[model samples]
Structures are given as structure tokens and as C-alpha cells.
Target: MADLFDNINDWLMQEALDENPLTSIVETFGRRLVEGGVPVARISIGRSILHPTIGLLDVQWEQDTGQVNTQAVPRQIVRNSLEIFDTPFGELSKGKTDRLFADLRDPDEVARFPMFEQLAARGMTYYAAFSRSFGRTHHLYERISNEFRGASLSFTTKRFSGFSQADLDGLERVLPAFCICLRMDIERFVAGEILETYLGKISGKQVLDGQVERGDGQEIDCAILYSDLRGSVTLSQTLDSTAYLDTVNAYFDCVATAIDEHGGEVLKFIGDGVLAIFPFDEANRPRANMCAAALSSAQEAFARAEHANRGRSGDGLPALHFGVGLHVGTVIYGNVGTARRLDFTATGPAVGLASRCEGMTRELDTPLVATGAFAEHCPRAGADLGQHRLRGFADPIALVSYPLT
Candidate 1:
């Protein structure tokens, strides 16, 4: 066992030295976990050990795509744990997921994990959920096998048994090395891959992968703003579809570029409309003084676009015009919907009100309008645009105009 572990360690060292140490750490140690005294069914890998029902490594056995061994694993059990730590207990993972976790030293919780028994129905015998906390977040690790298949007594015979105390002990013994390997992998992945992915997404490289907030399922005070091209409809009608698409895409580029530069996350793109958030994070609240930054960013974006459309003399290119609305309120900011389909959108009247406020920009002949909540913190911005009665709102709201200096 020492020799085998040494080989795996060396493989990890080589990966750490040569390629991405992060991927190698997960790959090397993840394999050892699955092969440990069980007829493993499926395996999954997560970044850290403080896993709240997430997979660190995953493999499934299939019968038809045709095979003798079959494994059934819950899809949500541990796949997208990248953002689970903040997903409040009982919201995503149950309050007590396992016996070996923060605040769960009780022996009864050892059986609280439903996967152990569920996996047994299909001949699975035993399973385990392991975790470790790294940095400010937690990571999870899981391994399970069928009674008949898990034992795998012979090369030809796949059998399973419930995990024995000795087996669990064995797992406990080698976990330190595994943790070290996984830590290295996580660092590499975050630095080499995740950062680049974030940069690309923020810059709208793979436009489909937009921003989603990974936060607790609770209402948080935030400033939600939306923008849409004013003359998009006429442009699409006058120009061919391909040309219109090109023009709209270029418009998207302008909006995203500004959002990224200003530290805002582009939530989603709706046709020619862009939804985004500024200074979003836990513990951060909407402040009128800081609101200028977002508005300034938006103004700079329009200036750039208008500057670009100057030389397109006869292209029938739509005038680079957009209306922006801002509203500050307690909006639900986290991954919402379901495991299969989730949207990172701000819920509550604040977002819709912001949209409605933006719509007013077209009607009011102004480029920007902010809700009273948005202006609540601005330093002497009341003198600029002043107050107005917002439609659908009972009380009158005070706000400042766009293009903050």
C-alpha cells in the first residue's frame, strides 16, 4: 500500500511540476478513494473537503450503453458544489448532511445521509461522504458501492458490502495525503482555469455563460440596473437579419466591456437588453455615493459606442442610444429555480421596477432614471434630476439624472 501510494504521490508531484497541479491532485487522489476496499459504483471530485453534497470525482456504471455493472447516482448529490457553501442549510444541503461535519458530531447523523440506503437497492452496500474546509470554503468527497458489486470479491464477481469500521478507518488514515493533493489541484484550477473562465465570461467571450450569483438564499440589498438599445427595433426592420445581428452583437460588446471595467457582473442578455449588477457581494449594501461609479461606467459605454458609429456614414446603423434604470432594494440574489435549470437573476419588485424605470427613460426623453432607493446614498445628487412621482409606486421618489460627473 505504501508503494502504491508513493506511485500516486509521485504522479501528483509530476503533475504539480509539469502541468496543472490542481487537475492532477484531484485525478490522483480521487482514484485512490474509489478503489479503497469497495466495489465502487460511481465517483465524483470536489475542490475541498467541506463538501455539502458535492462530488470531488465521479464515474458511473452503465448497463446499456451495455455493461454488466450498473450504478445509479443522484445528479444533484454532488455535481455543482462550486457555490454551495453559501446556499444556506435546508435550502440546498439538509441541515445535518453527515455526522462528520460542523455542528454534527452526533452519532445518529451518520445514518442521516439518504444515499447510503438508496444506493443499496441496486445492490450497493456502503457509501461515505467526506469533506474538508479550505480557505473560506468547504469541499466534499463521496464514494459508494453496491453490496454485490462493491465487494468485487473476484475479478469476475462483483459483490458489495456495507462499509466496515476497518474500511472507514482506512479512509481516515489516508485522508491527509488526499487533502494535500486536492488542495494543490484546487489552487491550480482557480488560478489557471476558473479565473480565465471568469474573465472570458465577464468579457462576453462565450456569451452563453453569463454571470450567476453564488450566495445564500436570502434577500440582500443591492442596486440592480438594466439597459437596452433605444433604436434596435428600427435597425432590425431596416437592415437584413445578419446585419442586424452583427450590429446588436457589437452593441452587446460595448455594454459588457463597460460592465467588466466597472466591476459589475453582466447577469444576462435579453435580445438587445442587458441586465447587470454593480458592487455585488455578501455584506455589501447599496450606497448612493458609490452609485456614481456604475452610472459613470454606463455613460462611458455610450460615449464609446457613439464614437464608433460616426464613420459608418451610410450603413443605416442605428444611432448608438440606450436607456438605463437603477433601483436599490432587498432582492433575492442567488442561484434560483432547479438543479436542471437555474437562473442567476434578482427577484422582487426592485428589478422589475428598475426595468419599468428604464422604460420611462424612453417616455420621459431622458437617457437614465434612478429610483429613490438608488439615490438614497448619493452625495448631493438631488440637485441634478431631483424628485418625481414614479408610476406604479404610491409614494413619490427622489432621484438624480444620468451621466454623473
Candidate 2:
């Protein structure tokens, strides 16, 4: 039995070193426990993680289905769940105990936690929870006395005989290896999430692949889409700080959501303007996909803006209007700015050209304008605007306007 447990520890360490996902690790651990003659019915691991949008990350392994399910619980939703505050897991989190065990077969003991009663109804006769820190060893005393960074592990068995002392001891012995695997995988998940959130997907992967040095870039052909809200300066002057911020966020939602849904990566929100790109493949059909996606995203943004404006009108607020510019060209997309600070963005003539097209929207009295190149590839006919001299352009720039409706 000792040899079997030691083998499991060795296997878990190897898997951790290999960086297998957390879900895969949990599923394997559950299978191993049942193989070792432990009647494991279900296992769950929960951790409060630092994330931009999620508060709790939990994984569950079910014996019947042999499935591992994972979920990200929103911060507010986790706070509102009263059952968590009443459970033994909550007690462990507050430093009340190193481990908690409940024999669900006993009504009085089950009555102490309502969740245990629910588990008993599901044929779960025994429940055990353990907590271990992922932080510094010197803070071990602080961790036991005060809540710290760690995970809470719980196991439930549906076996009629319930979990024996040996079963419980085996779990305790293997948990150190289990926590180490979880920490390694979770760190990978967190780093990926944070990078993707701060940098757009394409740029985030570039940074992760060691493209952090200043001027590290590549020239890529992409359809650039730039959208800027109209009357933002006036709105900012009229509304209070809170109301103005709400208006800005509402406007951003209309544009950003459309771009995101249509497979464009929003690179930055520059004041009231949003910069996004849909990269073109170098294959035979390059422009069709990128240009079409950009056009669809622009149409969706206009429609969403109309809906948002109607809502604002109902609230007696001014209607919001925005202009979109679409252009397809090659640009150097990579890290820029000083050594202390870096910005991942596209730079070149096309970037400036797209911004110029957006500026033309107000002058032409249209919501969307595309460069001649974008219009040619979009497959949709647009009203051609004759060549006109644009700021900083030596020659006249010809463009096409897309209908707002």
C-alpha cells in the first residue's frame, strides 16, 4: 500500500512537470484513488484565484460519469452564495480548521451544515475537506492563523460503509503532491489569462513566445478597423465624471462587443477611439476573410449603436454616434514604446490611413468609410466618394462609403 501511494506521488510529480491541465490531473487522481480500493464517489477542488473577471475556479470529478468539470465563478455571485458561508469549507477558509470531516449518516452531524444534508440525500455518507497553502513556508504559521493563498480540497463518498480511517490517511498522504500539480497548472492558466486580457490575443501570444524586446515586430497584412465616438468631447464637458464614464463604457460596449464577436482583436481604446484588426492569411484567399469580417463587424456595431441610442433616448440622454474606418494593408505589428514601457500595436502607413478614413466620416456625413482597397475586397458595393486631398497625403485618397442602415 505504501509503495502504491509512493508510485502515485511520483506519477503526479511527473505530470506536474509536464504541465498537464488541472482538469486532467484531477480526473487521473480520482481514478487512481478508486483503483487503490478507496470508494471515491466525487472529488472537488476549489480555489479563490486572482483573476481580472473571475473570483473562484473550481473543478469536480464524478465517478459515475468519469468526467471532470471546471467553472469560473464570478466574484459577486460567489459572495452572494450563502451556502458557501455556512459550509465546513467556509470554516476551513477562515482558519477554523486544517481539515473538516462530516459523517453524513449521522443526522445531527449533517444538520450542522445544510450542504451535508443535501449530500446525504444524494447517497454521500462521508465528507472530508483539507486546506494547504501555496505560499511561502515562512508564512505557514501566518497561513494557519490567517487566511492565505491556497486551495480547499473536498471528497465525498457514496459507499454504504463510508470512508475508513485508512482511506482518509491515504488522501492526506497524497495531497502534498496533488497541491503541487495544481499550483503549477494554475499559474500557467493565470499567466495566460492576464496576458490575453492586457494584450490582444495575437500580441499576447507574441509576448509569451519571447517577443518582449522593443522593436520586436513583423509586417503582416490585416484589415484595420478604427471606430471613434462622435460628440465625446462635448459629452465629457456636460456630464459629471461618473455619468461621463458610464456613457463612455456604454459606447465602448457597442463597438468592442461587435468587433470581438466578429473575430477581430481590439488592440487599444485610445480616448473615444477603438483600434482593432483582423489578420489576413497569406494563402490564396487573403482579403476576403479579413475584409468581410471587418465589414460585418462595422455593420453590427452600427446596429448595436442604434439600439443603445434608443435606450439612452428613453433615459433623456443624448443619442450616441460613432464613425468606423476600414482599410487593408501591411503594417509592422509588434512591441513599441520606451524600454521601461512597451505598447503592442500596429504601426505604418496603413494605420495612419485608417485613422484618416475615420476622420473623413464627419466631413462626408456618413457613419462608415473604407479605403479603395478595402472596398474592392469587401464584395459589397459601396458609394464611391471621389478622390480628395487628405491631411498629410501628397496625393488625393479615394474612398467608398457604406450605408449606415
Candidate 3:
């Protein structure tokens, strides 16, 4: 336990201080408590969580009142912790004691967690948890919980051996260091929010550490937008390698610029094409972000293409254009590939749909086209182009997109 606390303090000073400090501080503490033998812990930024889009979540973790469940008196109730969208899900797991892989052999589980009967098959029993808050955005909540079977020091054996009390005291001593870094996180979150709102977005890249908080460098549901320079292939064939790269880079500049303008993160570029993400945020859904960004990027790309073609004195050639596609649904969004090397790209059904949309941009004589889902939520969804029966999908989807404005 002493070693674990020392590690937490060191991480608090190091990893906790980053572009977004509050989130790092909370995660640091939550994970440390898990390793501390508390088995289970949680940080409640407020008594519960209250937000508009949380309709799908209804669980004990959501802070409804400052009363702190005086109605229940949870095993280890700490107040004013971090606020997260997934809090209810984790709390349900712990409160219901459904996650214990060790407590299955114990009889207490039958009375305490009838729902966790499957847990005993896996060998688990009861769990312990701790929670607290930090940072100016005291809304930040973090929790740590773990389980037990009939293993280790039982409740009856604790009186005969004094090690349990000693261990808890050691954990208490280590908690203060985490508190220090949490203070810094609070300051940074407030300062950064104020600065950005006042000065405007300082960096061209999108800011998304908040949305990806739970992604431990792995894949998730995200809208991926791919934009390719249609005429670049022909242009590159005529130019030297250096000139080709310069031309491609110029097109990349335009695509990336539009993506950032509409709150999308550029993940990578494939030669003349660029891949980016319209990640879900506190305000908007994933479907909305994807269509808005695709429409914006297409307009931006076409404008630049026309301007460049005119500047080049294209006496007989058609103005350059881009084929763009957007599809919404689950796609892997983490670092996946070789163990030594990986790329944070989404794959699966949605990506294929996006590819089909891009193909339609060329066939339909339009710069922007998206799958059916985009029309459902996009703020600027204009008209339906018609239904498309993609090669693999079981049902034909209604393709929709906006005319470049």
C-alpha cells in the first residue's frame, strides 16, 4: 500500500499535469485505489450527475442531490469528485456487485448480490470502493471498486490479526499527494475553459480529450470522414515527385482546415485522401457531428479546387472536385494493428458505408453525400438524393447529403 501511494503521488506530479489536467488527476487516483486493495472505489464529483443527454443512463452513480445517499450510507462515500457520462454504468456494476470475479465461493453473495450468481462461477464475492473529486470542474467524478470471495483476511479473522487496520491507515496517508495534483487540475480546467472561450481556438487541431477519456488508446464508436482530391491523381502523374507531394499537401491543408473548423480531429492521410473523426461531445451526438463536418469539408474542398483550377488557366479542363462520404454507427476507434506499430483508425461496416458515399460523390455529380443516418440528425440536412443498395448491407439505405452552399 505504501508503494502504491508513492506511485500515485509521483504520477500526480508527472502525468496529471498535461493539456487537460483535471481528467488525468481523477483517473490517476481511481486506478491507484484499485491497486491499493480497496477492491472498489469511486469519486463522486457531486452527489450525482445531472445533464440533458443522459437519458439512456439511470443508475445510483448519477448525482441527483447533495444529500449523498444518506438514505443508503454507501460503504465508502466521498463527495465532490469527477463527473463522467459512464458513471452510472460503473456504479451499477459495483452496487449490484455484478463485476466480482473472485467472490463466487462465498455464501454472502447470495444475500448481498443475487444478480451476481454468475460471479461465483467465476470465483468472486464482495467488493470495496472509494470515490472523491478534484479540479475547478468539481463535476469531474472518479471511482475505484474491486471484489473478494472467501479469500484473504475474512471479517472474523481481522480482530485476531491487526494488519487490515494498518493497511487502511497507509492508504489514508497516500491520498494527500493525489489531492495536491487535483488542485492543479481544477485550476487548469477553469483557466483553460476561460481562455479558450475568450481568445478562440488557439490550435488548428480539434480539442477532444474530454470525449476520449475512457479510451485507453483503443477503438470506439466515431464518425470517420474521408476526403480525397479527385484530380490530384492525374496532376501527380504529370508532375515531378516533389511537385506531386506539394500539390497533395496543399489539398490536405484545405481538407484539414475545414475539418478543424467544424470540430473534427484529423487522424491520418492516405496519399491524396485524409481521414478524420467527428467524435461525440457533451453537446452533440455522433451522427450530427459527422454530417455537418462532411458538408463543411466538401464545400471547403470544392471552393479551393475551383480557385486553384482557375488560377492554373485550365483552358479546356473541368474544375477539380472531391468525392466525400459520411456514415454513422459503431466503428473501432482505438490504436489497432501490429503490436509494435498501430494507427488510430475506425474499421468495420460504417467505414465501408463511407467508402460507398465517397464513390457516389463522383457518380451522382455532387461533392457531398452521406448514408441514411446522416439525414436523421444533421442540423443542415437538406434533401435525400435517393436510396442506395450498397453491396454488403442487407437493407437498402436512403442516401442523403447537402448541396454545397
RMSD to true structure for each model, in Å: 18.4, 3.4, 19.9
Per-residue C-alpha lDDT of model 2 across residues 1-405, encoded as one tens digit per residue: 456678888999999899898888888889988988889999989876766667667899999999999988886665667665586656776766779988889999899988888889998999998988775332322222345567889999998878889888878888888899888977888888888887877778888889999999999888999999999999999999988898889888998899888888899999989999999875743678778889999999889989988989999877878899999989899989999999999989999999999999999998899999898888888999989777988999889998865
Point out the higher-scoring one by TM-score: 1 or 3: 1
Model 1: CA > 4 A from native: 1-216, 280-289, 314-316, 380-391
- By TM-score, highest first, what's the ranking? 2, 1, 3
In order of appearance, the predictions have TM-scores of 0.49, 0.91, 0.45
Ranking by lDDT: 2, 1, 3
Clashes of each: 43, 0, 49
- Please report the candidate that would top lDDT against the real structure: 2
Candidate 2 residue runs with Cα over 4 Å from true position? 135-148, 282-286
At residue 385, candidate 1 shows an lDDT of: 59
The residue-level lDDT of candidate 1 at 286 comes to 37
Q: Model 2, poorest ten-residue lDDT window?
A: 136-145
Per-residue lDDT of model 3, residues 122-215, tens digit only: 3333332333333223231244332211011111111122225444554455455544553454345445554343222421112233322223
- The weakest ten consecutive residues by lDDT in model 1 span 148-157
For candidate 2, the per-residue lDDT at 389 reads: 77
Task: Tell me how candidate 3 scores on lDDT.
Answer: 0.51
lDDT of every predicted structure (CA atoms): 0.53, 0.85, 0.51
